[model samples]
Target: MAWYGQIEQLQTIFDELERLLPSGAQLTSFIATTVHFMDCLINNQRGNLFTNVYHNSTVRPFLLPYIPSYARLSHRKWFRYAFIHAFHYYCSFEDFEDERIYIEAIFLANGYSLDFVKYHWRQFLKRFNFSLIELTDLN
Candidate 1:
């Protein structure tokens, strides 16, 4: 499926999950199911590689500009964590090696160092694996 299609599929699942949230289901269960749903949407039986790329580089640029500067500044730890998660999600979904390199350049031009990007990249991978395992029971 195309990217927008995948996103729409996730949105539909989110809408369903939101409806389920008030049912007193365990928060961990809800989040795990939600993440698993997103994983399935992106992976679509193809496997992990595409999902990784889509989650990381392709999605970062759009998301970065929208994050409130105050939030990014004052909540640096949380922001970094969230950013890495989103980036990892994008990277997980798409193959974009050249785009990854390009995004690194853009990040540098925008005042982030390659080291910073790499740090998040590694962090995301770790979290991604853990989350995937937690969500799908497929570690």
Candidate 2:
């Protein structure tokens, strides 16, 4: 989908989340952070902004490459699903890590379900870790 369409879809999801979640400082903070994350992800300059930071040896190999054709076809849905999972993982784990507060705050504000988030988190960890292990063995 086009960037505008993606933004619209995210806005709709946020609206639904707002309706479902209770009002409070926690909710407000989560919503703000979620919106900011979405904006950053969708922004054209995001590659230049965070790609290097995020592509460290610890994380880079697990990330899907930014190949437009593959992204447009084979991996678009996977990318979306992985991102949702990543966001949730970042949120729940960060509660313990403290240093991850910025990313965690965004996920909480977005109002993704804890159950769904947890499920995704496990899947992401399993898949990425498996891939990392396989790559290491090959090397």
Candidate 3:
């Protein structure tokens, strides 16, 4: 395909991702979509990758300018943590809170419900295996 075709396809993928906000969002889909969006942002030219695709490269700069600045430019590590942890390939909590904050910010930025934290809080915890369920015995 041509360069313009690739750009158009990327834009379409990005737009469809926007369609999956708080209502129709699934954790797996969201992660995949974000990865695709990141690919477009970092692809300066087709297959020209001396740059850091992970966005965690101190050796190479992150290229996703479209990712909100408030999301913190140094978000790659926490994202990597979440990605790896989800697969149970690795598990650690060095800066897990920051990762949650980053994902939350992205959800809100994309017009997800403002009460996302409240509504999905349990699901989020369960997904990450950090349940916070609390109940009192009232027998």
Candidate 4:
């Protein structure tokens, strides 16, 4: 069938690429409905593509400490950017919620107050003029 031919072609390409790898390096790949790459988990579901943020299991969760005395303008800016990236990267409300909680945990671990994180989270939702429920319904 056409599907079998496509699989053969793909294997050929993978073999060629593997041959080009430098010494002591190995080709790591997955052939499945889902795969993780960088900060995103890519999925192919019934021919539909979806994505969610990926967290590596081997890496420790840590961030630069956010000391009250050392709070800089850049710190606040980075927080905003993190929220924006989560909002844009997650394809579903549930995924976004998970990322939001993970972000809060990282910030809290770094010494940010719960109130501070919640306030900015609310502002982010307000800027988009939508609640989590609305996002779920839309998706």
The candidate scoring highest on lDDT is: 4
lDDT of 1 by residue, 1-139 (tens): 2233455677676678768888776433232211334423344443322343334334555334545546544433543555454444553323333444555565566666667777765665575564434433322
TM-score of each: 0.32, 0.25, 0.30, 0.64
For all candidates in order, the CA lDDT equals 0.48, 0.41, 0.42, 0.75
Q: What digit string (tens of lDDT, one per residue) describes model 2 on residues 15-124?
A: 78778877762333232212234323321343222211122345433334466556334433553354544443332333223423333343444454555445544555
Worst 10 residues of 4 by lDDT: 1-10
Model 3: weakest 10-residue lDDT segment is 130-139
Candidate 3 C-alpha lDDT tens digits along 12-110: 776776677576664332322223334222223443422222334353332233455555525444444443443231122323344445555655664
Candidate 3, residue 126: Cα displacement in angstroms equals 3.8
Q: Clashes in each model (backbone N, CA, C under 3 Å)?
A: 22, 2, 0, 0
lDDT tens digits, residue span 1-139, model 4: 0123477787787789889988788877667788887777788877777777777777788565456886464576667777788877887777787888888888888778898888888877788797867878736
TM-score of 3: 0.30
Model 4, TM vs. native = 0.64
Off by over 4 Å in 4: 1-5, 10-30, 62-71, 131-133
Give candidate 2 misplaced runs (Cα > 4 Å). 1-101, 130-139
